[model samples]
Target: MSSTLVVGKVVCITGSSRGIGRACAIEFAKHGATGLVLHYFGDDETTKEIQTLKQEIEGTYSPAKVTTIPGDIADPKTATTIINAGVSAFGRIDVLVSNAGICPFAEFLTMPQATWERTRQVNLDGSFYVTQAAANQMKNQTPQGGSIIGISSISALVGGEYQCHYTPTKAAILSLMQSCAVALGKYNIRANALLPGTIATDINKEDLSDDAKREGMIKRTCLGRLGQPDDLAGPAVFLASDLAKYVTGASLLVDGGLFVNLQ
Candidate 1:
């Protein structure tokens, strides 16, 4: 679909301070999302990034529109505040991307209860809170609906060596997307999950810097290359736009055929 089709639509992206979230926000803006609610968590540095992005958008687009909201998605009140800021600033929310997540690797035997709780709080609980808030806003919109995109991981589907605590939260996200899709279909709001494989994000580079580890990752993938944040941006745009209006409760895998090839 053409980018013009999504013109004037507003999109709220959580955890957009960096990595995949940041890339998604930029891509959405490029694809005619008129308004952007850039949500960051506990970071002052992101303010500068947001400002830079806003300037870039303004320079590139006819009329750039962007708003930044800082909050912890784990808190329901904060999530509500994010939704309200989007509505108050942009008048409406056309798409909500629940991308706020934390993945701290740990062996099941050695993982502490606190670690598990923290992971779930940010990944699963945060996703639920944000989706709830966005769905409420979307239901009341003149268009009477919007798209909700959950940023899940391929770890949700298969096992990883040292991510027991993190994987389950992602698994919960998939279920959350399905539940929301079923419950909100009547309201015309679509909910779906985007499952990305080992993308070259900063979080992964720290551990995968070794050649052996990097080689192993590439060997496992049918595409023979690690995924990039930009690689998944188009799919996200598609899901958010009218192009995927009939799609809901489905998990779209952007994993370079790794899962299928492994199976």
Candidate 2:
């Protein structure tokens, strides 16, 4: 594929202020995406990060416009605002990355209702809302097509001791992509899932802080190291680019072989 696979394209990514989403945002700009709509949670820390990200992208990748929107992904209205912002600024959205999510580690038996519901609302419900909005825009746009990438996790395929509430949401994201792929094929709108395994992100910072536990995870990967957010950025770029024109309803694992390291 060419270096500028996504050149001239406009991309939107939710939860782009940090973690995998942040890395993907930078990669997209480097790959020649002309416009970026970055969605972030409206918190002081993330708000600052989003501002910094905007400057970094626009400064480094000159002419690549960046628009940052702060919102609660779990709120359905937020999805509308994000998609609309992209269209208003860039004319149309060529790629949608439903990456906003939360995973509060807790045991299933003792998990509070609020924690479970919040997880589902943000991870699953948020994806549904954003994807629906983007699909509609893509369907009615001049080009009449776009790529939708859902950020899922290896937990979708396997169970985690403290991720019972979380895994279901990730699993739902994968299923949503599969269904969307079939539903939007005629419109040329591709939907797919990217599942990462044990990526070193804020969500798992405390969990990985334990040296022994972190080492255990690293040992499980064939790469002999924990996955980094940048590790998933290349796969994300491919999915959004013409390189993956024929790819839809697919689940690409960017797990550094951890998923297959069963012993």
Candidate 3:
């Protein structure tokens, strides 16, 4: 049987230069999303990487038209720029993956107010701003609806030793996704959150590198492993595709069954 390709769909992913964001970009391209707005932030080296990623996607995959937008999602204006870049390039946005975020390990006592505020700015406020911008465009589009995906984490449901600030922001994102689901449903837009567990991404480099911590995590996970960036691609694709047409205000956990180990 032939598979249905999202050939005409446009997907905008924040923090698409590397890790899970980059993986989602490639996954979307592989599945035939015609227009892609890859969002990222950082220095010249990072910019070049994103450019290369764009090239790779267009060349290796289905030749999906890829555009790169760079900015800090913490800035509301940056969020506007991201959504506008996609609309301006594709004429419409069919799905949005609000995936840009930061998580630095800091003890609550030692973590300054600056760090806490910055975490909130990027994780919670940023998701809010980006979702607002995307929802606005989605509502105004001729077809009048799209998918809004919030990239949350397992820490959102369970507290972490050093993520006092980081965990709350992710929890807020889940609530925000639910809010968007109810508010935007009238316009046919759906909102949902994806929670990834112990993914071996750059953000977790320090933790994952430790033998004991790594072994502990692996042991806790029923799947007996840490998740890879590509592990999230399938779920992200489903949330952004018609397969999830009736799914909204839901949080899907992609954590290798670790959560159930809450003993």
Candidate 4:
């Protein structure tokens, strides 16, 4: 009964420079992940914080190898690159946390085509490519098994006021996760989705800026406040670790009962 969750496991987390992605990377390392592939996207000048963050995680956790991988998730090849980098550095990829996503609040009628297309490309298409790459590796590897964690949102289950285009992408991921679970189960690959509620991340700061909009979410939540990045760290690690070996095609909500209390 070793309490460590993912000891000696190799994890790859996309969008790991900040926010929830960063939290997951740290959580896995703390829980005994031996290797980490931190995937990030930026101006290509080489993001310094990503490197600093990697150093801090590896130093704090000690004995874990952390590699920074930069690329655009929108590009199909980016998924291939991230997975390949992980395998090349760690010999194999044990878990993949597809946490890179975007939520641009926009009115349905006013939403530009570019906005819709980019959202589809990054949140849906990119996720599909990454999950496919990870699943294929898991299927062919000697161990013949691995876990895929798709970072979905509560918006997938419930409609949002301004997530007209964004919601669909998240919803698609849930469906995609289920499909992967069914198709890859024979290969021992587990696919699951995590639906986080209104989290206080820099990515959503503008969306939650309005006092009225912020309080509306608070009223629906069972917890008095919004969710923090740390709140999801536990759930993320559990899904990637042996503790959840039997779980697959499940969408676990880390949303303080917000969906349950939906009006």
Candidate 5:
């Protein structure tokens, strides 16, 4: 039903070579997106995975279209390259997911200046660059509208120990999304943020490898388990689809009630 409704829509996802971005790409394809632009930084394995994912989806669904573009989100030129790739390959971008992010954990007092700057550049500046490019492209399209999804973290809402540098950037992302949503709504474009809590990905699993740390995370979650990538895929699709047509400048939490439980 939802997939059928989204047929022929073009969705572009950045940092899609792995993790939540990868999962969102596959999920959108399954839901009848006309074409997909999978953006990766420098991971060749992720590029190969995108190819494989395209083939696998095509095998099960008709008109399964997918394309891959590799670039650094921190570079403004690379953002332009990604948008150009999507427009050239798919004609128009119906949805843009700004999902590329990095977190260098350290206490504020001991944090290196370079580390803080890199986090802000990638997490905050990258979002702005990609959103600007995508919005421009969306404005020129026939439908005169598009959806922008910023992948933020629960850290954006609450401060975490040893993550001072990372959380501030995420908070900035939410503010950016809200401002974009208000400004772009007049153009029929919408922007929103998705905040995921403690998902068990390679980035988050470093501590989970320790039983004590892992158990502490599980206990803090109301659901009594860690989050999986798939948990985020559905919500992302909904935001991009017409189902959330009126939902803009809002933040959706997909953390299995971790935020509330922690409170």
Candidate 6:
């Protein structure tokens, strides 16, 4: 049997300029993904990073093509743009990693309505729109199948003191995957959630910079350390590969045992 996972497959990963998305993009290429469609929020810094990432991946993995799209995930049209670009470049999209999101920590009572609304629009609503577009493409394709990996968080299962608005969006993403699994299974499309636990990424850099907070999360993990973005790459690969063909509506916690270490 071929040991390579996702060979010749085309993958679309949102927020792939950095963090978990970046790690997954590189891993997928290393494991034989033939094409990559990377999405990022339209900012000069991220735009540059995605371009560099495209060069690095394509150069390192010869013959593997990469397409970068810059847009706000909060806008529904961004999702449409990403899918169309992927299909135009690769003929089909075999996998989608819905990983673009934000977490602006704030106390519940004092949080601004704008904060709550923006988080909802990006995290929850964005995932729905992107997943829907991907699922629709997967359904109508010749093979009639694809895999979706939603980057949810452990906050979906537990609450955060300062993440009242953010947590709900993550939970909703988890629920969205569950429903998509049911709705898309008949078409051979698999939907699953990858709930990461405090993975060290740009998203939580300042929050983790606090010695007390950082150390506390590290100690809480059974692994004795915080998770790196690369930690979730393997699970993501498995889910996107045939290894997880039977896995759908499942929530895989890549937390370094943090969720189970509650004691």
- For residue 259, what is the lDDT in candidate 5? 89
Q: In model 3, which regions exceed 4 Å deviation?
A: 1-5
Better model by TM-score: candidate 1 vs candidate 3: 3
Q: Please, what's the RMSD in Å of model 2?
A: 1.2
In candidate 4, which residue pairs clash? none
User: What TM-score do all the candidates reach, one by one?
Assistant: 0.95, 0.99, 0.97, 0.96, 0.95, 0.98
Q: Candidate 5 has what TM-score? A: 0.95
Per-residue alpha-carbon lDDT of model 1 for 1-263, expressed as tens digits? Answer: 32665678999999887788888887887888889998988566877777777777667765548888887888888799999999999999999999988877778897899998988999999999999999999999897999999999998899888888888889999999999999999999999999999899876877788899999888889999999988878899999988898999999999888888865
Candidate 4: deviation at residue 231, Å?
1.2
In model 5, how many backbone clashes occur?
0
Local error of candidate 1 at 118, Å?
1.0
Quote the positional error of residue 142 for candidate 2 in Å.
0.5
Query: lDDT for each of the candidates?
Result: 0.88, 0.94, 0.91, 0.89, 0.87, 0.94
Query: Candidate 5, residue 137: CA error in Å?
Result: 0.8
Write model 6 residue lDDT over 122-199, tens digit each, in one string: 999999999999999999999889999999999999999999999999999999999999999999999999999999
Better of 1 and 2 by TM-score: 2
How many steric overlaps are in each model, in order? 0, 0, 0, 0, 0, 0
Q: Whole-model lDDT, candidate 2?
A: 0.94
lDDT of 1: 0.88
Which candidate leads in lDDT?
2
Q: List the residue pairs that clash in candidate 5.
A: none
**C-alpha RMSD of each candidate structure in angstroms:** 1.6, 1.2, 1.4, 1.9, 1.6, 1.4
Question: What are the per-residue Cα lDDT tens digits for candidate 3 across 67-133?
Answer: 8888888999999998898989999999999898889899988889999999999999989999999
lDDT ranking, best first? 2, 6, 3, 4, 1, 5
Candidate that beats the other on lDDT, 1 or 3, i.e. the better one: 3
Report the C-alpha displacement of residue 250, candidate 1, in angstroms.
1.1
Clash pairs detected, candidate 2 = none
Structure candidate 3, residue pairs in collision: none
